[model samples]
Target: MQRPNYPSGKDLLSADAVSRFDLDDIMERAERHLREEEMEKAGHALPEPPAPRRRPKVIATLFDQRSTRTRLGFQAAAARLGHQSIDAYDTDRNRIGQTTGESIEDHIHTVELYSDLLVVRSHMEDLPYRVGRLSYLPVINAGNGADEHPSQALVDIFAIRQMRGPIETLGIALSSDTRARFAISFVKMLKLSPPKRFTLCCLPDAPLNPAMREAMTVLANLGTAIGIVHDIRQTLDHDVLSIQMQDMSKFAHAALGNEAVDKEKESEPFTLTARKILDARSDTLILNPLPRFSELDTSCDSLPNAGYFRQVQLSVPMRMAILERMLLGIPWTGQADSFPPSSGG
Candidate 1:
């Protein structure tokens, strides 16, 4: 974990880039960190955690927008991984680039001179890519317009794989605004290891944004049984929850058969209550890219099938894994293992 050695001109600005990195190796290191803490509580001899060296790395963050989970999460993760997180913006939302009328390319270049990596959350979706195009340093897209939030997608996937099983064995369904950036990013990451089943739970003829639709096509080509459900009732159907129920098979395909959907529903576009979920395959996991107004009722918070809330708890560890991979290079694996050579190269 000395000043690490890695390929020059690499960056992490999109779901495709995140998919290429050794996510599995990164995650293993996080689990190692947690295990060390558990062992300490048991009054047992603590075995050496994965990386022994403790060289510190610096991460520069540039946010044109405000965020609670992502901004604080990156900073916390940097400390956990023995790194630094420096904000490129001030408390008043003042950015050097904005104050000086500098181009994003130049802004990225300036930060690369000081930090090991850059985390950008911009109002424009393409801005992260623009920065990556100019800077050789690794760039993480914290929240990029409405196009995607790749890191959030990473945390959700990691949590799901842990509770259920592998990606190939889960019948995953995402609800709420399918066209939102969170939804788009989450679905794209899921496509990296297309699951046994995926359903977009939305209203009738809900507009499928081109970005999301393309991702669905990719999963379909990869052999995942993808479905689009308009009604809350259809979500619990046998076909959608058929292939992957290894963890909840005892409930079988009875997700919502016994219960009735709320006759008096919320004034939201989509709603999933505990009753509907319980009557369906008890194993079908419900996910929502949050900031929810009413799309997801509060009633489901206590249910066993909810995975969205865990994403918040996992934001730090997932971001910590990214810092360790990009900076310390602790769990070094070949780029080809997860990261393919960039097409532009």
Candidate 2:
């Protein structure tokens, strides 16, 4: 199979921001990167990584909201790729001469003048979209409001594909809060690499029903089964389970007003007990994106199948692939066609 076609204008603002190339394009590259590291660790000599044909002076990571993993991961990725990552932010919401009441378009233009690529995280819903529109440089969205976190989705799919042989037909459970930005972004990526069955089991008040019901049609066209449920136990049969922290918007006011809200037991609905996991298929993979809150219990962490830490470990290479794809160039193993044909009704 030919290497995937990357677009001429190299900006990735969302999961489908560029063309939906084979999802294997991302995963296979990450797999090779990981293997190269493991080989080097075992005292095997390897060829040096190629320097970029056109390297950037700095990758500006602009954050309108705070982040730890996204910020630090990109920096580590940049360093590995032979580039510097700069943390760029505006505390007063004033860039492009915000003191002069400058427009966002002009601000983006000004931003492009200084940086090679813009990795942005915004409190606003579509700030990265507008920025990518105006700036000639690459605009890689770190996260955008409640809608998407494209890089997180990239790292996530990479982790899952590595753990399992092929992402094609795995039954994946999206448990806990279905409305979290991480879950939404991940599901969007799944459109390109549809699993055999996707089960979204959330709380009683989850708003994922209407939109996800529609996505089921699209996923079905790509040969994946889909189901939505409020009962978390229904996910016990899945090959992979990701438990997300519940949404806390409604309870924020109570906590701010000094009203104690007891939410620990409320989290029991989605917690993955050892019994639930052990009784499933022996190879079942447990996934979580952490700062876990109460959704993922501590007991699950030491389980051999727990993939969250390895998931975080893979983000370095995942982000490296993301940045290098858009900015510099990285090598791929060329295994897109080798993936098994997706199996499901």
Which 10 consecutive positions of candidate 2 have the poorest summed lDDT?
A: 331-340
Candidate 2 lDDT score at position 55: 52
Deviation in angstroms for 179 in model 2? 2.4
Root-mean-square deviation per candidate: 9.6, 8.2
Q: What does candidate 1's lDDT look like per residue over 1-345, in tens digits?
A: 133343443566666664434566656766665565468768977665446447567889887666678888899988867678898755354544465576555566667778888898876657777766566567777876666677877777767765566777777776555556666777777766778888876656557779888988998998988888766657664322211111111111112224432323343325566777777645466555454444567787897767666656666777787776776533323321243234441
User: Which tens-of-lDDT digit does each residue in 137-179 have in candidate 2?
Assistant: 7777787766567789888888887887567769998875554
**Which residue segments of model 1 deviate by more than 4 Å?**
1-9, 18-21, 40-45, 49-55, 91-106, 237-269, 279-283, 329-345
TM-score of model 2 vs. true structure: 0.81
Once fitted onto the true fold, the runs of candidate 2 whose alpha carbons sit more than 4 angstroms away are 1-9, 18-22, 49-56, 90-103, 248-265, 275-283, 328-345
- The candidate scoring highest on lDDT is 2
